[model samples]
Target: MIDTLLILHLNDSHSRIFPFGPWTNDNKRFYPSVIRFAYITDSLKSLYPKHLFFHAGDYSSGDFPFNTSVGKIDLKILKLLGVSAIALGNHEFDAGPDSLYNALLSENIYLLSANMDTTSHPLKTRIRPYEIFNISSKKICVLGLTTTEFNDINPYQKPIKFKDPIQIAQIYQDTFNNLNCYLKIILSHLGAYVDTLLAKSTNYHLIIGGHSHTRIDTIWKVKNSNNDTTYIVQAYEHFKVVGKILWNLTNNKLIDYKLIDVLNSPNISQYMIDTLNNIKSQIYARFGNVYDDSIKSLDNPISNSPDSIGCLDIPTGNLVADAMRFQTNADFAVIETDVLVYPLYKGKVTSDDIFQVMPYGFDNQNAYNSRIYKITMKGSDMYNVLGFAQLIRGSVPIVQVSG
Candidate 1:
């Protein structure tokens, strides 16, 4: 029997729920909103009932709604969008295993991860290695592989060991081949580099990948040892672009494949628009107003940005350190650039914009109540702290300084 399947894929959408202009420097006027995405996907699914939606990972964090709501809003969006399956991203572990467990408990969608050693974690039984979909009596299997970088990105106190993703993918490919599945797809959060390696190693039909936030507009077709081709696709970051691929299967073999971009389509469903409106209202209620009229006009634009490799220098780091030093009148101040999320936009910068840069603090109820103690450290101790910061340069531990 010959059948067609439309696969809608997205990745590394770091909690950008609100609709905004495109991320790249293009003239595309499409406002990338979750509502728009849902509307488009729903319309397509109506036309193609044999379609599937998959998220490659990094679903939570990076936004106030994600942080404050603890992934509830994202889960709703995923469920509404009819996400068939999702791979775990390193950021999914940002809040530790307990929080991840709570998030998963609320989300009924299939969570696939083959390499994560959750034997000691709460999600051991909940997460499956792979999932099989029988559409039109045709067997379609999907395996998941998350990045090993979770070890570094997660909490130090709670260690979630990760096995080799490439090896796991190979093992699963053999297992699924024995099952005689028509199509085998690997939903991986192992980044593009590792996904490429996996494609070269395995004979899987497709690898939908995430991490590194690379925008691969075109599919990368890699041939395995047997000369069988494996397609790897990643749709940049954010919900600006949805990766669409049509798979034509005949007699249990994929005959033809076409990858296309489904930009923000204008046909928005009223239900989705209402859902988005409710989400916005809930977010505003939860966080309250960010700034008053007085603080709204504090639009002092700062010319500071981290390097392409995410290493911040004087302009970015020093400015933050100077602010800390000025606020507390400390002898010296050191601010880590890792804590800084998005950079200041070129236009007017309000208090809301600055808060978005550094939203996380010790206390969520009172973000400004992060404890700041003035400690009298010995000259040797101070020197050691600065020395340690220097050692972590070019990495997350890299800090900016002021005196």
Candidate 2:
């Protein structure tokens, strides 16, 4: 029997340490799910003894608690979980390069992104396009690809450039061919469609994806010359779930694999449950009073309500958009309410509401003044830019109304 290589995958966890009532009611059930994930990591480390861990991206700038910690707390958790390499998601740049660099340094994890140019930033040396991991006798070639749309969302941080993902993958593929690695995988933060397209064209055996926060368990078999099977997997956001990929490798070739969902299970470990509960209690103790007073229920529920078109406040949107318009001195300002939907509630709102809503901060004065307008693009460009947003909606399925 050939030795199996296990690659533990986690993605799109937008800082959800505890379950929301709207999402899942059983903290009894949810806490164990998290604990199970932690236990799995420890078990794999002992069982495989040659296991690797990879994260797709979007580690920061989503939920209120996560943004409040400025990614520091998340990094601590990831380090504790033993993440080896991670790709850069678009939200990773929400704080700009300096903040990201500082945070990355604190965690000291391998940051990979083939398309990103960190030369101008302090992370130039630390942030590489690809990294190779030698586990036992197997050479696992891993390449990272970030969304090029960073140019559109973060223009102020000039000098940072993104290469075409497919093109970069080709470069890494050629390098892998020369080195003759046991397995070739792409840690892609380029969304699902691009991962599919790249898998079809390349000889890669797996494409671990992020940016969409998709919960895909089945393997995506791409059609190509090599007839090589490409496995695509993503864990739904908020640390609510953990994705497990078990690969049976025989003489450097994958014979079989399995992707398991660690979140929605009935059986969970006691140790992990206790750890999670302790963390939650600490959080409540620090902010419980403030959250209770400020976090008021809505007169009407926004999600799943007949009166609600979507989970956004028309008045709040107008207020925020107008603020952008005034600050930028532009003809118009457009804000996507979906982008700031965190620390959210189905009822009355408060100060914590604003923090959760605008955790990324309104620092892009240039975006306001630059006359940002939405233009419909061809399917490909649109897929590249807005694809992740749609994917997130699909995975979480939060209803929002727009006028």
Candidate 3:
């Protein structure tokens, strides 16, 4: 067996494929993550021919690219980065299970979710509990487990059950023992706390984790049932950092590790530069250049505050409420302050800019946007809702009203 093994891990990189921040591309920024990852991966692969690259999960949403391509380009980008496999994230089923299944199949996306039932779900027989790799005379087994929260959040993924992760992990431990793998690792989407629980119970050497977007630069060590040490690591979200690991398999010791920032790289290959440039072009070609997708210019900014229309506040939420009222001709329109994510600022407003103002509440029918509901209630019930709004009892204030 080889003395050492190298690995790179990523998680919750929610489709922010391009340089993050303003509309313009800042090549200097560590973002435009695809290129940075490409440069980094190429450098590492050349030095160490045998290595494993993994993503803990959540490569699905959180960007225009995901909405535009229905998650095809997102998967393509990961495959382009030479990712061996990805753990199934909650957001993967955001567009409904059928769409997810088709996207994964069309892109040939490999996934792992040990606790999920493959037979009940549409992705029957495709995904596995773990993957075993024989690299450089050493066999390494990698098990995967997503969180139970996935079931709670994703209503569209029906008939799918999340089994107890600890139980599943132990079952996979037996698999590793019987297969005679030299090293065992758990690629998890169950946040840091649950990962700690797994480490305490099971005998995996390493756990690369995601969910909760934790940035664990330093190794978190835990002693397992047999009192063997298990180390856990997580890279921060959105391709900001990568968990780099080098373990000495022969001695079963962690030799080196770090959470590498994408910006702190040494060299840039010409191939990576061209690939980076092409990313913008592809996005533009697929979805019209958002920069030029102008809606209209606003003479003055309309604030999206959920305050009384006659008061000092700009009543930005009222405009949405007014629109809703006019469309349905409701007696009154009521909404929450949270619905308006960004203020409609005064400027040459584009479609892209408007999307940012209310960029949430995605449903299974459309990953792009959400639908507004119109309901009927008696005056007494209406009084209760209005009272609740005025009091702001919950974390989110249910303000904004229109006649």
Candidate 4:
């Protein structure tokens, strides 16, 4: 009964539906688009009869697709991709729990969070702690864990507490005492740092993960409670790459593994193409002619990159601050580097390009831009705000200022 299972894993997709980079000539390895992601993943599944398409979390928010549709598009993509399961990500609650409930109600994918007490929330029925699947007559189980540190911004209501992930892992593993699943997995959204701690504490066959966007190109094999191998793997953000590992279900050993750069596959899903074409009209109606004639150009690329955002006033932040300050006719304008995404490269720029830069913020309509508001701040208040911003999230500049 020795069977090898292909674990096709992805995480922190963050709604990057579009592909980036020609990068190289082979074209077999581009940054990857949602369309190409579907194709490549579908191909892989066909190659392996027994497989699981696991998404760690953050299936929503970031980039154009989620910005325009507020997760509907991503949900559709996930449904089409036939995701086996996904752990809940912090971004899923960016718009609050009610919004998350509505999004989940519209999709039928299994979402899990073992430590979250959503029992009183509207999402109670939609979310669960673990799920069991019968693959080739063998029962496989997957449990989930999400990060509790949401920076005090998630607007969590009462009774919806997120418990300790490490504690929950211990408790949940014990609950499956009689099940004896062929494989036990912990799908985690607690970031690599926490995931490392979890791997050391539990004895699961694998820990597919998300949250920190850490690229575990090589599986981080840890010795768990039983002194056996517990492999941890997390793919990088967007659909740019994925990790596929062939694991022996019989011996509980990793047979082989490889990291695939998601490239545009010619054999695309026509249904997805049609769905994309349908989404185009909705986008056009929301933000008219986004890719129309370039309305502007740039001399140099302005990037508010996360790689080096240690409270430094990045060029992208500087440019956005200037625009915001000018538009509001205010004494000063401040924006966060975190809100800014993708860089504004040197060349002709379109509305769509800027959308990639800050593809968040919504109002009555899902595709609306973040409304710029003027707030009167005294000298002392400004100083305090800047001070707090500097250390809010590990010495990163949470705000960009223009005066």
Candidate 2, residues 15-88: lDDT per residue as tens digits?
Answer: 55433323234312223334556766676678877688888987766444454445666677777778888887
Which scores better on TM-score, 1 or 2? 1
Error of 2 at 367 (Å): 19
Clash pairs (backbone) in predicted model 4: none
What is the clash count of model 2?
Answer: 13
- Model 2 TM-score is 0.74
Residue 182 alpha-carbon offset, candidate 2, angstroms = 1.2
89-157, model 1: which lDDT tens digit per residue? 877765556667787887755578999876676677667899999887778899988888656544521
lDDT by residue for model 3 (161-209), tens: 6788999999989889999988899999999999999999999999999
Which residues of candidate 4, in runs, are more than 4 Å off? 20-32, 156-160, 264-270, 291-293, 305-311, 364-366, 369-373, 388-398
Task: Provide the RMSD of all predictions against the true structure, rounded to 1 decimal.
Answer: 4.5, 7.4, 5.2, 3.3
* TM-score of model 4 (CA atoms): 0.89
Best by TM-score: 4
Error of 3 at 371 (Å): 3.7
Q: Write down the TM-score of every candidate.
A: 0.82, 0.74, 0.78, 0.89
**Which 10 consecutive residues of model 1 have the lowest summed lDDT?**
290-299
Error of 3 at 324 (Å): 7.3
Q: Report the C-alpha displacement of residue 393, candidate 2, in angstroms.
A: 15
